[model samples]
Target: MELTSGIRDFALTPDELSGFHARGYYGPFKVYEVDEMRRAWRGERLRLMDREYAVYRSEAAESGNTNIANYDRHLDSAYLADHITQRRITDRVTSVLGPDVLCWRTEFFPKYPGDEGTDWHQADTFANASGTPQILWPDGAEEFGGTITVWTAFTEANEETGCLQFIPGTHQSMFYDETKRMHYDPSSINRKEKDGVRRGFFGYDYRQLQKDPDWTPDESQAVSMVMRPGEAVMFWSTLMHASLPHAGNVPEARMGFAARYVPTSVRVYPDTEEIEEYGGRVSLERHGSVLVSGEEKYSHNRLVDRTTRGHRFVSN
Candidate 1:
């Protein structure tokens, strides 16, 4: 397959990088070709809306407010895989995490109108579930196990339609306690409630954390990330971010896709033999790792590859 330069020229500038470092995340960087992305979006939406493709809808309030509907290798149809693997994205990651990199996973998010927004949370707390070790950088270290998350907007992202919001600089901390999964309660406010602000599924109880002498929100500041169709924002895995609720009056839903990249050196699982979920303990090795980059190592275990088979794994 022929490869293009990807979106390097459109990469985040120095000021943009500074903002991201100071804040935790940044951008609306134009990644995919706009016209091409629009075509892909229209085709995918038609397939879903017309029942030509199967979609999994989240059970009410079980897995947070957001309902994620996905269609995979459809990315191949848009040549997204080739573009993503290009030097631009990979090189930038190398600059941060060093030479060895491999894409870990990818998924599409189709947020229907009136769909609930995701609660604010850091990605690292969930890293354990992926079988990847928690990465910590040593003092004065120039690089770490950099995981780049590329979130591409298949449609215009706006506050009215549940755009992403991020809390600046919240990623450089330790994992939030995962001893118990909190029940979803829309009315509950995080005790460190900045001016009574209502943010979604921040795993831990902020009220309790506020009392801990070492805990802080990590220089918190909330800002909505708006992007036009085809643009994307890439952020580190541990960044504190969440999406706003879709309040738009559009007839169709908002769609976005997130592709996660990680270096090959990171050991996926360290101590755990298996993880228990949905009344069963599943082996992470059996599921294997998701290939979002490199020489197209496809897997039936992944949502992207499964889409090619016309089957989806939905929780019973």
Candidate 2:
């Protein structure tokens, strides 16, 4: 869909871009016409039950009950895909990354009420098929090779419900070596106090870096991103961010969708023919379709694909 002529005039201002460049992330950007986007999200949620049920059964059968995974539950659904590619979203992404952008992948993160929060980590830590390291755009212009991550809030996100957080200005640096970092431990809860040190997700366990004489900042300071429904936050993939645990007793689970976009000029992994997130070696290009806008083409990835069926959950 084409954006309205006035849409280009709605792009972020220089001051706003500067804030993102200095802070590493920005927004609660007033993107979608709030009411309309909210309605669209609710419609998508109403259809989620059938999708969830089908996924549960399929996943259980494929991996056995012990190893079941729900990552692909939303793929192929028209409702969800439309929301991800909505014109309001694509325009903002194009403004940041320039005309040529490809969506590499999209994923839904449903943090159940009372569920533990995700580990603090940089998005770049997980490499896409494109082996290139994620870039940071301090200047918010095309010259920096910047990528845009648009995270849409499907449900109300706040501190009580495990909203996302980030360390301002942390994305400007290169990725920390994972070899020296700690592996993720799902069973044991991370109870470390934020001591003002700038660390990304799983930075705590990486002992060698922790012991570095130069690494003296406390690791406890992070800015949480609490947003209302229909509000979206955009961040560079290299930004150091993580979500807090859900402390609310809300009957419904917290749901959010993330879409990753990069310029088309970036080379995707060549070995993989098709993108498979579950268990196959797939390339980045295969994961998402390319979004061509004017002179630019952006890569579009689906974080959540809709399913044919839905599931119903009894509120506890």
Top candidate when judged by TM-score against the true structure: 2
Candidate 2, residue 165: Cα displacement in angstroms equals 0.9
Q: TM-score for every candidate vs. truth?
A: 0.63, 0.68
lDDT of 2 by residue, 170-240 (tens): 78764444334344332334444434322223222333333343553334667888887778898987676
Over the stretch 104-223, how does candidate 1's per-residue lDDT look in tens digits? Answer: 455667667766666555554233323234332333544443457778888888887788877767666634543334343334423223334433442233333222446545325777
Candidate 1 has its poorest 10 consecutive residues by lDDT at 294-303
Q: What are the lDDT scores of the predictions, listed in order?
A: 0.52, 0.54
Q: How displaced is residue 193 in candidate 2, in Å?
A: 8.5
Model 1 clash tally, residue pairs: 5
Identify the leading candidate in terms of lDDT. 2
